[model samples]
Target: MSPLKSYLDLYKHLPQTNCKKCGMAACLAFAAAAMRGQKLLSACPDLAPQVREELARELGQAADPQEELTRAMAPLKARVAAVDLAAKAGQLGCTHNGKRLVLKCLGKDFTVDPDGSLASQCHVNAWLAEPMLNYVSLGQGKDPLGRWKLLRELPGGEDWHRLFGQRCEKPLQKVIDEHRDLMEWVIDIFGAQAVEEEGSAELRVVLWPLPKLPLLIRYWPPEDGMESTLNLCFDATATDNLPIESIYTLGVGLVTMLEKIALTHDT
Candidate 1:
């Protein structure tokens, strides 16, 4: 059997009922997990026997998470090799240093070579590399409109909103709750700016993860028996500069970085 080439292919075989029986909130999420080899086809009890057998044959063998990420990033890297870095720099409001395209990522200068190889003082990993490549290859170079909106408000964002919250906002909120100085550290380390917005939030900080992709994070401290809340918003033109998946990836990446920093400080 041929291996499944994409998540959508795996998703089509699922029940699509958005039933949480598989431990994933939606069938789409389950499919994504399966593609990443984090979940097995048989884990979805609702799957028909025939479909399970077919998927088992087509999926070949489950790969480790690192291997899955490498496999998924292969195509994006190939595409990056085909793009002219200097040309993309102009289109994406980046600077080219003759050998690489430089863009501001989380206020740090990130450089990408023509072969999709990335370099920065910050950590580099498949998660960040994939999105950076996508931005260079597909981003439309739209200027941020300054109007902030929730991720769900972006085109095609509704389906991803739940996962985004679980993977990005909730985890980041936990980090902040545990480390009282986290918000201030992010502002200082990432060059984030504290912005005053008309809201009940006790703190609001704006960060530029990409040149045109600015993220606004708001934190509402616990009050009146209510738990604290953290929300992430982006410029309305975010999707125009990077696809929704890249946006989600960037958010998760940022949180992961902060989590590591917090851990180091705790140690």
Candidate 2:
């Protein structure tokens, strides 16, 4: 069987229902995953049996997330190569270094080479690199309006909210509940700003993962039989600065980082 060419090709075969049953926000997301071998076409129960069988035979097997991420990066990198980094520096709040565009990420300098390669004083991963490249290449670079909204409120974000809560907020809340000091440590280490909000949340901080994309994390400690809770909110213009998928990746990435830090401190 021949391999699928692109996500769009796979998308054409989907039910286009935007159902969340497959753990993805939409059929398009599932299609992308299917094409990358991260998910099987049969995962979508809505798919016709014959269609599922045909796709299963064609796709061969599902690749792990890391393998899928690596494959997805190639086209994104090519798009980045066509971008004029210098021209976008001002809009993106980056510095044009003649040969690269440098931007501050999580308080660390991340330099993007003209060829779309990334270098940072801190560790780099596909999760971070993919979003950064998307921001540099496709971001409208609109400034945050200081208005905050939940992930579901952003354009095309409704379908993704549940998965975001499951993969990002819930896990981070567990870490914060276990290590309360981790919040302050993240603020100090990542150059995040502590903010006051009228709520039960014991701690709140805003992290600028991208110049125009600010994420606010609020943690409410358990009290009076209530369990601890955490919620991640974003600027209303966040979708303009990064796609919904990239935003989800960013949240998951941040949570993963915090989990590592908490583990290290515990040891």
Candidate 3:
């Protein structure tokens, strides 16, 4: 991240008051210098020397964090990057009428259990639902291809599919059904152009007698919290002719997929 961005993030979290006791006119200016390494911790007289010392210590600890992070993240990064690249290349899956059909592996086959707790069992599902939620709110006028391009660069994404696969047990359909229901709503709202036909494993498209919009499918495992999966499908055509930068702007396939589905329904 750039110094400016770092400063901005810190600034947002700061007490927005311009007390001037910090020697700077505003917290933002102080943050800017802190980010640029142009200001010293003691520069802020407003903060007690003890507080400044503590903050400085914390910042110093994080100064060389990138190297450590790189080491810890190397393996997972590669896996996610590959998937992201595939998604942008239109390889991982396809879309129709702006809706997307995602390949889902239920907990039966690959599930992620956090701390072996029941309350936490739904964490992963909730984590995956964020993009879907965003799509529901802003699907219309969205560029699905652009979104995929941006998603390719996001972190933690490289491990998403791999982690899911590892935790899964058997491919379940119930999860897919949940995901499908969510995407279907987006498709119905957006007036999509194409969709992934229910029960089909192949990535295919069509305009005439347009396939169903916002299709939902699921693979539910017999076990309770093992590894159920959700597969959400949408129209793919919305992304076919998009440009690279546009794709970047669209930012993240998961969300874009939902948006496309919603947009199709709206139209």
Which of the numbered candidates is closest to the native, going by highest TM-score?
2
TM-score of every candidate = 0.78, 0.80, 0.22
lDDT of 1 by residue, 122-228 (tens): 67855577678888888999988989999999987886788789888999899888997877878887889998767655788999877778899888888899999
Candidate 2: stretches off by over 4 Å = 1-29, 32-69, 197-201
Clash number for candidate 3? 72
Error of 2 at 257 (Å): 1.2
Candidate 1 deviant stretches above 4 angstroms:
1-67, 197-201
What lDDT score belongs to each candidate, Candidate 1 first? 0.81, 0.83, 0.34
Looking at model 1, residue 61 earns an lDDT score of 39
* Model 2 clashing residue pairs (backbone): 37-63
What overall lDDT, based on C-alpha atoms, would model 3 receive against the true structure?
0.34
Of models 1 and 3, which has the larger TM-score?
1
lDDT of 2 at 95: 89
lDDT of 2: 0.83
